[model samples]
Target: MKQLMQALIDQGARLIGLVGLPPMGCLPAVITLTSPFSPRQCNESLSQIAIDFNQKLQSELKAMQTDQGPTIVYFDIYQPLIDILQNPSQFGFDETNIGCCGSGLIEATFACNVGSKICPDPSKYVFFDSIHPTEATYNYIFKKMQPVIDEIIQGQ
Candidate 1:
């Protein structure tokens, strides 16, 4: 991660925003793939991996930030996503465990087509498909990242 950041910096990138990894364990696809019998539950082991990686990346970014050179900001999506998944009601989400398309487990992309089964209201669901979030979820995520985005724009 540091190497990649350095590469980008070397290429004359001044301000950089590093987005943390979302909770893959909490994703419907991962849940379905990892726990077929109990698709509603998240795969903790996968989520822990993302958590550990985010911690290391955050620590590295903190160390990289100095008064002398380029500005770097760590935009956290992991914690906010986890919070939304854990407490869907807070974010006006009725369904957190599954997506809105098809079975809301493993179907995505081509499989989740126009003719495919979908929920009546996608806004109520956190995910649109197994791997992607709904517009509403992205809106919530954007709200969480707005301050950082504003800071970036203002700094520039």
Candidate 2:
């Protein structure tokens, strides 16, 4: 990922923003797959991996940001997502453990079709599908990352 970003900078890109990975363990699909007793519970082991990877990515991005390199900004999508999951009510989310699509357990992509059962209110759910977030979740994430985006845009 760093190599690809550096390549883009070498091609005359002035501003480069890298979005770090989110909490993989918190995803409904991962929870369903990993947690046998409690599918709704987050798999801490997988989340740790994501956290470690994000930290390394931050370090690498910092190292890559030199005087001649493009204005590189690392957008953290992990912490805020975790915060939302921990306190769903604060973010106007009623459902955090499961998705809005199908059984809200394992449905994603092709499985989350028109035939699949959908929640009455998608805005109440953090995830639209087992593997993906809803528009509301995306909006919240965007708001959290907006400040960093502004800084990158202003070349600060």
Question: Which is the leading candidate under TM-score?
Answer: 2
Candidate with best lDDT? 2
TM-score of each: 0.90, 0.93
Please, what are the lDDT tens digits per residue for candidate 1 over residues 1-156? 778888988899888888888998989999888887843688889999999999999899999888865899888888888888989998899998788999998998999998999999999999999989999998888999999889889977
Which parts of model 2 are misplaced by more than 4 Å? none
Q: After superposition, how far is residue 51 of candidate 2 from its true place, in Å?
A: 0.5
Ten-residue stretch with the least lDDT total in model 2? 31-40
Off by over 4 Å in 1: none
